[model samples]
Target: MKIRKLIRDNNYNEYLMDPIYSRLLENVNNLNERIFQKNKLVNLQAFMEGFTFYTSLNYRSTPIDVLPRIISSEFFFKISNYLSARSYVLNKFIREVYQESSTPIPDWIIKTTPYFRSEMIGFSPPKNIYIHVYGADIVRLRGIPFILEDNLRIPSGISYSYKAFEYLTRFLPELSEGYNVLKPNDLEYLYDILRYVSGSKDPTIVLLSDGNYNSAYFEHRFLSDKLGIILAEPNDILVKDKEVVVKTVDEGEVHVDVIYRRIEDLDYLTPGLVKAYLRGWVTIANAPGTGIADDKATFVWVPYLAERYGMKLESVVQPLTFCLYEKENLEKVIDQPTRYVIKKREGYGGIGLAIVKDDNLNILKEIFKEYENFIAQEVLDFDTVVSVVNDSFYETYADLRFFTYYDKVASAVLSRVGIVGSRVTNNSSGGMVKPLWIIQ
Candidate 1:
């Protein structure tokens, strides 16, 4: 009864409400209450705590129904394969966008954004990989998965998800027993990817970050340490003799062969650094100028790219995107702006989003008049899941950020759930990050 009461109105709860999983939920809650009373629950606080600057994660709440939420291996494989297929299609489309192909999009949209790199027109990264790392956001609406955004620049949350899985399962080992947990060697895989790009056996690798000002700065540091790569800031980067090098305290200026860069935009790249990358002196993961695929407008073309490349994007539903640059689409959105969620083309982290209740349509109208850097998608009522907030149980909509690599179809998944009234499932927006375990 306790577990059933915790269950939301989603269709999948019947399986969770089964006798076996219901007991698992009770056991997890019992463990949680015991730890809550004895103050042992604070043990898991170390992961999100210990740093004042990185407080974006909503540790105030977490999910207790691990068994119910652990997706089936069959579902996992389908989603993973879907992302792999889509990633390959997008990568191929990007090559056409840059190098050459009969254009799927108008040339005007291409020249408008700063992401279109004239210099990289004929240039290709090592292994011909434009997107070394990729990720996409998926929100299930009425049982159909819809991709919210495409992350080609820096597909974060791999480390965070892995860290949670690496420890939280150990903290509550009972929840992990029945299922075959799929734990891949993330750090080693990353190391191998970097090494492969570097084209060296003993190449020096550096994890480049925007520094402590970044909200995910903790992840940058954590990944660097785990992957056995030096963490360096933008200022720490130097281009000497057309080669990229990083200044480290332990070693005076070490030559960097591979840079696992996390900069948000191409604006973060210095001219010299870009020159070095273009000249093939060093390799950058995801490569520079890959953000074109990250544009929300570009997302509107994902399905088209899939169709053109003879690939299937059926792993999830494609949100109906209103490309605002077109006259009719722009008019429709401006007329009934609240009917859709208006998003900045290059925006990330769930920022710069406007919807019906925000009551900023007038302001949005003026902004749209000057710039066409916005796209509208019909509002989606995502499916809900059981969530615990401040020790209280309730229902919440969920968003999953499943990671994809150039080589690996899907590696890990991180789920975030926003309670009944909340719209955004981003951790920074008071949404809680929940661990997603794969049912073996």
Candidate 2:
């Protein structure tokens, strides 16, 4: 099969050559054929139907792979351990960034960054953690993985990853034969984090959302249901006398101790909630203004900040970034634009990116006018997985997004793949998300 060939022939997929992974791929291959053929649906129809069902699980419109990819427990643990150490460094780094005066980050960058929230200057959230939940995109070059970006701003997709694993396993129980495929960990500890932050043994925690229109609204609802917390909309949440409360169907004006926020805009956070949060009457999982660390320009300082804080990531390294704000860096990229990918500091969900491919001089010159808002980074010829879609195996570009709690350990991962002819693996685009199955 093409998947077997993928493992055998592709140098980047050398890890799949292991006997256990090979066997798992064979089972996935067999199952893919069965799932497609038995439906008697046309190829397009089959893929559409499968994707429809996947989205019905309430993930915002992203297709999933036909089968879960194999990851070793050892590798995952190693990644988690390394990430925890990195988190330790970042936590200290953030503390320094928010300081009134002394900081390693350039004052101009901090003051100019749109993501910087000044409201958080004096306040410290529970555990003094600004990044309560963190997510980072990881892409591999050759066979080695490096972090692509950080999502410290109320990161989404953990719930989606959990649901994907839950449903995929149920859909293909037989595939688990002779394999110890561990289920993804639950997010119940989020409530514990909430409670600890709130300084309440039984805090009234509510999952605050931007509502159903948001792409991660499903995550908001799913997490609320899973953690047994009330899911409150903006209108539903109220802050009175600096103590937050939520309107309820059964219990009117119920007091809320913690708000597990899903929205990023501080405006949506409501002035009353902000006041309550500042007063320590309520806790927001990620305090407002965490965007300081979340900014791309600030990301360039992570290595420096880590070193300055007397900690460094020992396991995985991140890509080298070139800030376009520098005239010399701009000249170098203009000299050879094709070697790097140009990205706007504020852009997310695969937007505001230029690959600088053939004959892209005009666009590059135009975008360069506002070079201060962009950064250029070396392009990675990242590794690809054999992603089976509609009973066909396509060597697909893939990346992993690891989600972690402030306690410094990665708890869940969402693996995403871009179907052939696509560059980005973000779910908001046409990419597919799936569970990264670990062999325990």
> lDDT (CA) for every model shown?
0.71, 0.72
Tell me the TM-score of each prediction against the true structure: 0.88, 0.90
Worst 10 residues of 2 by lDDT: 38-47
Candidate 1's TM-score: 0.88
Give candidate 1's total backbone clashes: 0
1-440 per-residue lDDT for model 1 (tens digits):
24355564446533343333554565666666553332234234543553222444432323222333566678778888888898898889888877884468666567676677778888878887888788788877655678888888887777656655655565667665556777645556567777887889988998888877676777788888787789998888999887888888987898889888888654455447777888999998878778888878888888878899898777688878867788898788767777888788877777767666544565475556655788888888766766545445566677888877775754568886664577777756656566677656
| Candidate no. 2 TM-score | 0.90
Q: Where does model 2 exceed 4 Å of error? A: 6-9, 14-20, 29-32, 35-60, 358-363, 408-411
Of the candidates shown, which would achieve the greatest TM-score relative to the real structure?
2
Against the true structure, what is every candidate's RMSD? 3.5, 3.5
